[model samples]
Target: MQPPADLLLPDLDRTGAVPMLRQVYLALRAAILAGALPPGARLPSTRALGRQLGLARNTVVAAYDQLLAEGFVTGRVGAGTQVSRDLPEGLDAAAPPPPPAAPPAPAPDAAHRFRPDAAAHQPSALPFNTGRTSWDDRSQAVWRGLTLRRLARPDPALFGYGDPQGARPLREAIATHLRAARAVRCDPDQVVVTAGAQQAIDLVLRVLLEPGDAVWVEDPCYPALRAALAAARVRIVPVAVDGQGMDVAAGIAAAPAARLAYVTPSSQYPMGVVLSMARRLDLLAWARRAGAFLLEDDYDSEFRYAGRPLAALQGIDDAGRVIYVGTFSKVLFPGLRLGYAVLPPSLLEAVRAARLLVDWHPAGLAEGVVTDFLAEGHFAQHVRRMRLRYRAARDALVAALAEHAPALAAEPPDQGLKLLARLPAGMDDVALAAAAARRGVVARPVSPMFLAAPPVAALMLGFSGHEPAALRRAAWALGAVL
Candidate 1:
């Protein structure tokens, strides 16, 4: 017979000062690690655990939620929660072990076809990754407080599945915020909340493109966008971008029966060029002519450091071909995994159905907290503060690069958090990046952002997270590496 589930928890020592919930969590986790609670073992229900430990049911539930978030355990409908079947190797063992023996070698030309994108494999050590925020202690405290408050509410809906479209409060809040900040005209019914910008991209691809359909993407665009299109098995035609952004005439001329076109018009990634108004008009005309959907990834448009903020493509899209993708990752934090898409009326139902089938919806509590954050104006205030801070950092980076590495040419942009520094003709970006890593400065090569061939040798450095002083130091360190 199996041991009682309540007996799985370890006895607590009287002298420990740790919080009861934390102690219970650690003790239960320790049992799993020690194989005292083996794989497939069903954990006691929250009520039973609370009774066993003389704690509140809510405390046990919170512990379980943490475990679930961390992939330690899983809860199922009707069935009790159980330990994850694929625990880390040797984690269930009692003793520390040695390395395993090498496996047999593969035959030559073994048809091993899986190859990940180069950008995905690259080591990321930068304080501000693409679409990430500078999360300080205060933000963490706010998140914790919100989580605890949500936990206190007695709602079965919190534990069960949520509306695939997303929580109504968040969708409504996003609609209000976008209208005021981005000049986007939309209602709560038009907003479709997603896991992140990536998920929004995927949903758009699924709803708009069928297998073998053609799509046009910016030549040196975000690599993940390229990866997503490739995964969908759609043929992607690369449209070259100039200083003013993607060349509209060239894109129109090269259109190969494309069902959609993806562009970052506000501030192009890696290159950091805002699409000119004339070109934006020309591109929209082409979309109208070809009956193509345009995906506008407004990833980092919030922190425009130069001149007046440009109106979004969606705001100006009269032909109803633009699908606007926005995310809170840049403005608030990345790990929250909150993003939204404003779809054209024609594609709304199809995209909503696709989202329903794919992961149902984002976490309910996260949506609720973010909704409250935006409604209370904390989100807007934070964005304004970060915009100013990022501008200062951008200015410092440009000045430092000019002072230290005079030979290198740094392309200055009117807006966006990241800038590209064009390296000398023969210098290898990979080698320089490796050297910079040794000096504790992180930067990415722009070559990996290209599709067909490397069009330029440059380094993409983000200034959003680092302050001006830190950027100056990092620039000096990078100058040494180069």
Candidate 2:
């Protein structure tokens, strides 16, 4: 079929930012919608169109292909291409334009109140900030090599929207790794890959919680998790965490019908106390009796510097009550933004559906690279090397505290990344932290982490991000502030 002689072929731009094919496609699309090319108007064959427009056959074909895919045009076998008879509703000039997007509303007070960890806010900008990970030259080199390999031949399927649950290979890899490393019991089917532990916590709450539902949150816990729960309008029962971790009995007394409880069981945040084996059972028991779920945040449990890593609460759960959350942010790097939630079979469907509604899914490229990182043994290798390096840093920090500031008692964590140093009696930790920040060091106030009154006066100092020299220097400076 040949186009009419009087029909004007759209002009192509060779030097413009827009591709020649896209330009041709847009012009043809606009003409069809404007009724310049009416319904059932036969278009020239690909070769004829190319010759008429002085373009290669492929370019014209590509333009037509896009139009065909988008329903602006149609093609018939043994016939020719024509504009779609049943065009989209808005294509006609008589159709009303879509209403403009409403202006964004102002955020609530809580938006300003809930802050990320100090280390999350460009920790490298200052010295010895909490929650930062040490990235040595070897780790960076290995990461670069993995990234290049992953990019060398990216799967074409990744170009499209990925599975809401996560990439299958990544999930499978995580499941296998968790089973061996963290003693997490799960199949790939039960794993919901999330952006991070933060999102994993949010997703679980979205699935299980309703407005005003009772939720047991650890006192002096991770602020980001607290903010998320607060935003959901749940009644947060601040459960005390002692040497044994969350006081399960106090939580039962406070909120017996609580739908969920968030715990850093393996190593409690800031304090770094391992939840005792007895307490782990008590928590699991409470969840079973109350028909509640336990969200175990197994963050940084892999880097146990002393005895063996404490068993994760998720590992021992036979009642299918624990929703295990783990993140690569601390172990691998914060920017990776990769994490997983091992849900019980009962909650899998609801959680996966909820995840689809929020952000759809994480990027496939990052997941794939991490999948390869684990499968190729790089993850274990990195953890082994980092454990040794961080253990050294932790020891140096503790020793420096003993030498420089004997008043500030520092007990190194057997597991996890940071340590809690108790301040002098009546010394305001918030004021001390502010003072320390001004001196180019981060001593996160422990009182703010507490939800109940009469909070402990302490500072949380991280040693994982810095070398021994920097850790020692930061400790000496903190002593001067005290």
Candidate 3:
């Protein structure tokens, strides 16, 4: 069949980082999947396509070969190439075509609600955005090398459904790392690998909570965890946090019968307060008395700046009531989507069962690569390098805030990626964040982290993702907004 006169060729971005052949493949694949090219429709010959697109025939061949290998197209002698008649699932010709692309909509009103965390890491987005963790080129190169090595081995275990509690080797590696770094005490058998801390928290809540059970949450807690608890149909009692972190007595007074309490002990989220040892013991005692479990999010414990890093809450929990959760998102790259939960001996079987039913384990390839990362000493080296770099960034950020935004005050925490600055009295942090976002600086409001009316206005500014200079620039921008 002759090429359709109106068939639009894929637009290539010559300066883009994507390879030309891969771009061609993706465009053709999209056209086929979108029904722009009908099933069994003939594609131009490689030679013809190369000529039409003004390219070398080998480049066209490379694109066509990839499509053929992926079953997106088929070729035969004399018939040339055609869109695959047996399309992959959900790409059927009989399936309704997607609606035409809508024209770009007008920008919403300035007061329109926007999620501050969603676009923090966009290529063009502002720097110093909360929850944005940096992955340097060197680290990415290391990860790529590790990933290639894993792919070369072609493990049969990775090809099959992974162990629900996670790969044994990976679990062992995690246990060893936790033992050394965070002082978490657990056997490999007690660990359950999850698709990041979010899923880890979700799995724990699934196994532990019944409908409408009261759970204690830090007043200004991680929003994602709160959402998970709500989804599980649990009542959340928001307990206050101070310099000592979540007040155990306050939590007891708020929800004495609460079945579980989620706390970030090493470095509390949003507000970078390390739960004092006294408060840690107090919380543990409360949990024991109430016969409840503590979900300890040991997120970002690796980036301590000032003093020696505090031991994990789970380390001192002799009562076996603490479920220690940790993630590679902050330490490594967030896209890795790898995290683990160290369950107590009592809850191990139930959590494993829940994990099996929930996603049946995280991606085996990531688990395997990360296992190698931890075992081969790359993980420790990377963390040390990041710690130094982030410490510098944090110091610069604090200095900039003091110089530029003197109205805001923040004491640098010994650990974690973000610095929480208390806003001036009567100032609206949410509004300030919105304004800063409009001006291309992502400043997250601490108010939304609260369950009730926030007692004070605050902003959580991230420093780990940006360089010292970039952090200064973001700080200057934030000061202007304030």
lDDT of 2 by residue, 1-482 (tens): 34565558566667868988988888888888887787778878888878878889999899999999998788989778988878754555686688999999998876864555543355353556766787778878888888888789888867898899998899999999989987889999999999888888888988899989999988877878877777788898999988788888999999998999989988788677778888889989999999999989988989997777767789999999999999999998888898889999999999999899988888888888888889989889999999999999999999999988788878877887888889889889899988988888887888888889359999888888788998888888988987
Cα lDDT for residue 255, candidate 2? 92
The global C-alpha lDDT for each of the candidates, from Candidate 1 onward, is 0.80, 0.85, 0.84
TM-score each candidate. Answer: 0.74, 0.76, 0.75
Tens-place lDDT per residue, model 1, 138-181, is: 56676677767777883477888888888888899999988888
**lDDT score for residue 406 of model 2:** 86
Stretches of candidate 2 exceeding 4 Å from the true structure: 1-124
The alpha-carbon lDDT assigned to residue 72 of candidate 3 equals: 89
Candidate with top TM-score is 2
Best by lDDT: 2
Clashing pairs in 3: none
